[model samples]
Target chain A: EFDQIHNYFSLNPLYRASEMRKDTAGLQAAKNNMSTKFVLFSDQKPFLLRSEEPSRKYKFAVFNINQLGTELLERGTVIFLGLETWDPDSNAWFAVDIKEELSDIGPKFFPEGKYATPFPVTMQMEPTQAGIFAEAHSVLCWLDKYKFCSTCGSATKIAEGGYKRVCQNWECSSNKGVQNTCYPRVDPSLIMLVVSPDKKDCLLGRQKRFPPKMYSCLAGFMEPGECLEDTCRREVEEESGIKVGRVDYHSSQPWPFPAVLMLGCIAYARTSALKVDTSELEEARWFSRAEVAQMLAGQHPHGLYVPPGEAIAHQLIKSWVASSFSNL
Target chain B: EFDQIHNYFSLNPLYRASEMRKDTAGLQAAKNNMSTKFVLFSDQKPFLLRSEEPSRKYKFAVFNINQLGTELLERGTVIFLGLETWDPDSNAWFAVDIKEELSDIGPKFFPEGKYATPFPVTMQMEPTQAGIFAEAHSVLCWLDKYKFCSTCGSATKIAEGGYKRVCQNWECSSNKGVQNTCYPRVDPSLIMLVVSPDKKDCLLGRQKRFPPKMYSCLAGFMEPGECLEDTCRREVEEESGIKVGRVDYHSSQPWPFPAVLMLGCIAYARTSALKVDTSELEEARWFSRAEVAQMLAGQHPHGLYVPPGEAIAHQLIKSWVASSFSNL
Candidate 1:
């Protein structure tokens, strides 16, 4: 049986009525519906509500249409997230990116709400809510960065309920056929756990930007004309000088840190030599199974640790420790 | 044992010396080396040399450094492909896109060479040469479209051996940490063969643009915050009104029809009913295993056919037919 891993940003709850995107009137009706909810963002930060309990956790702060005034609604880019439920009368969910100048409006709407970055907030929230936050933040970031059309340096307008951007220049090549250039760009990246030849050890690397003593799976973006397997072998060889033999798919995660799909895999190394690329990594070394277990349990002698459970890297390491490497 | 399918455009022969990309002097020396060869493109079409045999097959028309004048080299965007072999003294390979006005120069360099669209040429070339053409075309297409920075509207300068385009504006956020926006964009798409609940039949769909009677698997560009599984389920439901229950990874292919990595899968359908979305698909229906086999053999009663062997769809269908559904 293939046991799929549902990572932090993977458990989305919305129905994503994709066919309804072209129905502008239906979207507008949903936006004006009394039961509709809106997730607000300011400067790409989500407006989250703090729990009153001792844990002080955060949850998505959603507002009704009335809570957002006409001025705010008009100024912000509202994306139709989808229906909250599959029922025809179910509430619709939308995400709007409020301007930085209107950052105080979030507090006005929800007195206990504050805008915060996705990192700690996503880790703290429920998986379903985190998934929603991921979708909203990724779409908003794409919208912010893609103001001008890549084909023609012309201002583009939001279309298809924020799912697409259309260049105003009618004669632009992007406006011709598939309009693929107008869609939100999602960069596919490979993140893998590299097992040694003996299968007793796994390779991990830490970048200069990583937290002290923290190391995780080696990863890089998927380049053109390369499959997931090619990416795995190439990235492993480039980063740690390890030659990979067999690559198996584990699971995938939608990393909304500016729209990336993390394709996770287990790559068996043909060679164990570690020649770390200093430009890409601070250090790369082989970690034995026992040491990995200790790191996961936060009992490592060197104060070493992996990423949190929310990251696919942690799941990859955990799976490696649990499996015999042959099955995976 | 897991058998890998090496589809056309997947078998790249070059040794991509990624580490040396940053060494400008070294790249220059490799470019000017006597053994270095260059692939030429005009208006996004590859220059091909037709074979003298009856097959009239085409191969990549490569040019040495001397054949390309300084004026033409300066006018075109030169991309270092990689070394022809892993040996230190091996020849280097590069790709350059010539201006439309300079199309006549290709014939001058090689009288037998002709610039043609990648479709027929790619289908007719050797698999290794086709892979090179896929890479060169994808990269050149990216360079052509991404003249302006997505983050900032400023005209960008080529960097990192055509792998990156840096915004000239120092204030642009893309210039800071990581410089992710500067990298070439490769969109991840899902192409899946949907099997029926009983596993006796499979679903196929045809877009209006597809050749008459040619049915292929359902595909869609993955949206933000969606795992491969989620994309499979959503795209299947949206395109054919079939709810996918379990999605299994088959393999992947790099389709350079403007830079897409096709993630191929076999999805088990929970619902067998079909309600085709006309806007997306011209028609969709379930074909029994016998019918699929006939179609693959080009013996379908209605002259129906599947995609060619070079496509991942063909591989997915072939695997399904060869293995018991449980094993796949």
Candidate 2:
């Protein structure tokens, strides 16, 4: 039952053929195939097609290799997303960063296409499409940021079909051994719904950047040498001064605002004191079960609300309420 | 009860006062304090003291600021780890990379000290000391590798008391806004024990690097846009050609051999196949409960054995045997 919690951007349909990444000839043949589809990104913003038939929705604006010119195809960073199916004739999907060539080729290929920031655009797309967008965005952004090696400050060349980068300098430490520094980095973060000792209330906090009347679960990036449970407890105590006891894993979501995995958990708190760390949160307090239900249903008297249904925080709160805070 | 699994190098006792990291004056005073203890690392090797009175044991060879000497301290890359207690008069702790100054100061301050690689030495120390070494080793190694900014090929200066590094160039993109590239990175990996559909056996694999007759759980680093469950299933199938379904979270451990948070899980196999991917594993096979018990007890007729108690793999195996493959 817990594994059924599939948040938005979590249901990827592509078959990531990781073993085929090292086969340069196979990759080249796939790219040359006419059935291959390409998703385009410009400055981390995705290109979409607006649909107004049944209701307002967005679809990824995919193109063929021939549609994108040779120069754009060669110069842009192309990442093989995966195959739609495992069959030999299956459509090979890919994502390309068209930022440098967008100005020159935007009007020619996708004159009617609309580009928007990942968050808003992903919210309107279907679940599978959103998942694909998450993967593409994270990989493309990582490529843009890591043009040079962190080990020796030397330029690197992409390898393993965009899955890895290798330093050009032979003396770089990353080339000396089986180092993961050249791979796409994914930060694991903790997001928890903390229940009070008596189980009557759950703790929620609002960041300065959040909407005025919205509060969600507390989240922070995990540090080196700390387990997920330790991260959960530390984030709760540091941001809201709530001490957590037993932590239960709920589910996980891939938040690709530059690649982070949100580990959702239900933490039982031992202390009820509210000492908001001003530097981290604008306000933090416990909400009763009734108040939380109202917030989730958009019926809060003060117009307060939790995060949207697509967010893992929303699922955590909903799960806690559904279980009546038992057996968690 | 799952939280009781305190694996080796997982129980850090230091109170990480993260809020005080930005206060330069506070950090300076803490560093200059006489009671502050320093842990020294030379080329990622930790210095330790040997105790031969009773059973042979190893302890962290810690020194105060005065004993470390100002020249060595000034030239070395020092990191403020944490405090022993939250009290104002509590002792502060720090870890310093003495690679450059080790040759000059090694004979003077620690002539009797013995240095060894982290893995062998950690196996001999107490749990608390091993946990501290985990933290120190991970952070120091991270700092050594990240001498330059990943965003731009420019020199970087340490900030946030060794928790972060900022690019020196003002034009660097990392300086423009909040970026996690500056912080210490901890990769999240999935390690799992797979149970057969009939629940009569468990799957295990051994890489070429592993010792002879030793098979452990399958594990691989989580890629972007992948949840821990997805990672577990993918790694299992890829390494062993055995499909997995209905994954359950077990526990987590911080394996600080270059910083990784191991997310442990118990996965159920949907199919029982024996096609091993030779590139990732030398061999994989299903082991009966009796064989596993014999291996755990070191009584296998073939002389096969499981990992030691300090490893999470051993814990997973022990738990599975204790539960009779029922609820888990």
Candidate 3:
């Protein structure tokens, strides 16, 4: 029932496209048409921009950031307000549940993840909300930890729609793009569901941060100069201590949860032994096909489950249990 | 006979999995001891370290750019070298052939788009040199274009092993990583081999840039909010004016050619007619399985051929011809 409710809630009309497009040329249309008021909140506190104060604006430039309007241009702008949320559930600052919108604001934003589709929901913050939030949050998270150039210890700056920064030291010359900031993006990752040799069970693990009774696939970022199988094999071996052979990809999902391309695969276990690494995992274990079926149905005996509808993990696990690999 | 040469030329081994770790801490054991250096040039171009004196001893950073060396390491001197082809057949630089050796005479010079890889392959550009070249060249080429911040018009520097950059605009919040520098590294793309209903023929298209006597899958990048299928459907319609229905996942490739994740699918064509978008493509036509097989084998009676090996399009076409869609 909860899953059913979840399904209905995700039926966002603003982004209800049957398919996605790579070249979206109409984002400028939405930006101008949808310039509304925004309350940028930090840690649940909202930052209000007062009138008569010539709205302070910031442009986060991503080179060729796919704007889906009028020739599929990629340049755009977003203004952010530093407001905290008075949130009750998390007991944090009052945050606006932008993804869980109950009201419809005018201005057709791109809904589909692909071209020219307006964003599914309005954050009710700024007209250019999600674009601003995602760029600022993901890039800044890296910047905070990377204040000085790791290579030369030179100071760096935030430049271009918060997309890039340059080195001051004349001796230091490094060029990096604002990927999550600039351009349309795809971040390669290795994620998979490991199956038992006998075909009766599958492997599942839980992170410490997961919901009370949820278990999803194990995943890790791909290293440079490596193929997807190499990544899958390496990640599975490290995370679960289970040897996998002949790893075949099932599908992929554009998981923009802070920017990652989740590459899903189904691997056959070379061995049944589970040498768990507790430090890496809060817990790890195997589940039967029947048990997995229940979890997908939300009828688990322990009320255990997989990821939500938006996650490819859920779709992947379901595909495995039903033996339908083309569901992507 | 040429097929054998074609096959041999195609089996490029760019990166070999140097090691595998059973657990996280096992990374220490996997460190420098695990990975192997890919031999870059067939002519053995040695990487050199810098010294003020011409007679001084030199040290070159050559080997697989192992992640173990880079994961916890943030600071290191990186050398950036622009491309200059060597005359492998003539023993000098003038008679340069693109297929010959690309020497890395590393004086440890730095400019941009040059960082230590997860594996350090100084000279070993093999089997997939084209793909490898595409990865390094495209990423660096794009970075070379952006030396300053577009926001407040300031400079930027590289950080995090050239994985990121920062702006010099102190007043700009994103200057401190408050904004995005770019989107993610990989761009999600959908490239489908549209097959007709009876399965007697398949659809293939060629861009102007493709080599003569070749055909490959049609592809485009995924946009901001679009779903995978959503992308496939739209790209199919837009490119060839042939609407597609019931798109299913097949496989994907990490097309390092400028960091694109090529999502491969076999779509059931909803229309037999294809009105070519000459603006987007040079030719669009149908090829029988017999022709495809010949193309893969380069035995096409009409001299029509598929893409070279080491390409996702080549693999996709092969997968379809062999009916490689059953197990899952």
Candidate 4:
């Protein structure tokens, strides 16, 4: 099942030439290239070029140098995402910006409501576009909120080609070793598809924020003193009364609902009991393997639907079901 | 070899009992118990009950509630770091504080210089003590720095039994779902022992900050939008120009020199070449299995030494050597 869940967000068609980011000459050259592409966001919504026909799939309204000629660029922060390897050999650098400059200029260029789209809608586009959107959205979101230093009240300056922020106060501890204040942040979270001892059923839970009849895997942030395995076990036992034995890493997805790295896993449970923690989850129950397969296929008798392809939860459930069915 | 590398820091001899954290009454009752222990810190250094004789090992200078007398307790913060099950079923809630309230009073109660020891020195103590120290140190370090909210720059308030911080601003986004701003921080890092295709030699690197001839496994922070396996491969290649194939998780250690989860792994490299990134590492080279074994045994012929048993890198090398030797 390697790369079975391909085309998810963050699986971009770009080579993040991170090693070359520090080279000012190389970055400058790539940025000024004619093939260089720019994507704009307004209030977290991406300015995408959509097809006129409703039946056609969505596409990103990616802008080139002529489309966003150097005007009012200072009003917004620009992040150098990476060089697009769409052809796997091209040297075109792609950057993204979330600024009022684009919001004002976008309406004059593309039709209103047709150009700007939220992140969730972008999932309908090609995988490369969605991945680019995730990279831009997450970095822009972090910049918007983290304008001030957490250690001190001093404002920070963007460095390392928008990949890092440094506090202006030279005396602050953030200025010292490793520069903790700098770097883009990613909250690591564990999401597991817990299987029963008999392997015929799996545990699923739903939070209050989840849609009606939609259940997903148990998840929580990886805490300070715990490993990935222990985090999965603890979160499972906390949300539901299942005692997990062995945990196997499945896949990973970059969830940009404010920057999260979703580590998906397949957990083996020793106990099949249910003692739901209502505070953490609204409902938790064991679904038979057959029923889970139905849910994944969107033919559940009860109309219980799982999340779409954009979510790691969907992939986790789908992968497990496919493997189990093949064994049968 | 499941718990072969046991008795390391952050490997506690007790359950965290996190489900009971919100139970204020239970916590209050546990705090006043005679068996409940208090480990105090001064400036991030833990206070231990050192032996008068040089031959005896160090111990944590834990004080009970009856010993503190409840006077001047308000000057510092206290965090409950689970229970110690060393005495079988005896319940003892262990708490730690890093306040100066003990700096003046600690010497009066215990032997001079014996009660206040730095963090690295505490590694000489029992695993349970070291684990407790890690918990307290990580939580206190976070609280010490995160006094103000990064989102709004407003002062925050402690909530959820010192596990979370809430912004005072009502309209702040921290007040919304999930409360991202209010959690203990843990930076995830990957540390891997890369082995050659022939399995006879392994790669090691040394930073400028490291002691002379002390080469450990390569490590780097797990960046956002990347998985643990990818982090290992990327970091290894970036630091030493070694292209890795399969990456296997070995173990994890909570390195709380300000809260970092060091995930140890065993990497299988496709190529055994070294093109060291001089900026990231001072030196990197391939060491034969015989040399690594000598370093682990603290009897290297060239006077080179690996980190002691305290570091995950040492354990990783030791585990690989043992496994490889068995194959012979």
Writing each residue's lDDT as its tens digit, candidate 4 over A245-313 gives 888877677777767878788999989989999988999998887899899889999899888877889
Leading candidate by lDDT: 1
The candidate that achieves the highest DockQ relative to the unseen native structure: 2
- Over B1-328, each residue of candidate 2 has an lDDT whose tens digit, in order, gives 3345667777889877788789888998888889899988778788887756343278777889898877777788888888897665689899877774464454467677777777755766777888888888888888988888888989999988899999999999999888877999898999999999889899988889898999898999998888888888778877888888888888898888899899988998989977899998988899988899899999999999888877789988888877744533
Give Cα distance to truth, residue A67, candidate 1, Å.
Answer: 0.7
Candidate achieving higher lDDT, 1 or 2:
1
Give the per-residue lDDT of model 1 (tens digit) for A1-328: 4455678898889988877788999998888888898999987899999865444377888888888976788899889888876665788899989889988888997888888977766677778888898888899889988888777778889988888999889999988887567898899999999999889999999999899999999999888988899889889998998999889999999999889999999999999888999998999999989999999999999999999898999999999998855522
Which wins on lDDT, candidate 3 or candidate 4?
A: 4
Instruction: Assess candidate 1 and give its lDDT.
Output: 0.87
Query: Interface root mean square deviation of every model, in Å?
Result: 2.3, 2.3, 9.4, 3.2
What DockQ values do the models have? 0.62, 0.65, 0.12, 0.39
Scored against the native two-chain complex, candidate 1 gets a DockQ of 0.62
Docking class of 2: medium
Give the distance in Å from residue A293's predicted Cα in candidate 3 to where it truly belongs. Answer: 5.0
Q: Give candidate 1 regions above 4 Å deviation.
A: A1-3, A52-56, A325-328, B1-3, B52-56, B325-328
TM-score against truth, every candidate: 0.96, 0.96, 0.56, 0.88
Native contacts kept (model 1): 0.67
lDDT tens digits, residue span A26-144, model 3:
32222233232222222212223222324322221121112223222111123221212212111111012112131121112322111111122222223233334433333333434
lDDT string, candidate 4, B26-89, tens digits: 7767777887777776766676776554633566676788766566344656666766642323
Q: What CAPRI grade goes to candidate 4?
A: acceptable
**CAPRI classification of candidate 1:** medium
Q: What is the C-alpha lDDT of each candidate?
A: 0.87, 0.85, 0.49, 0.74
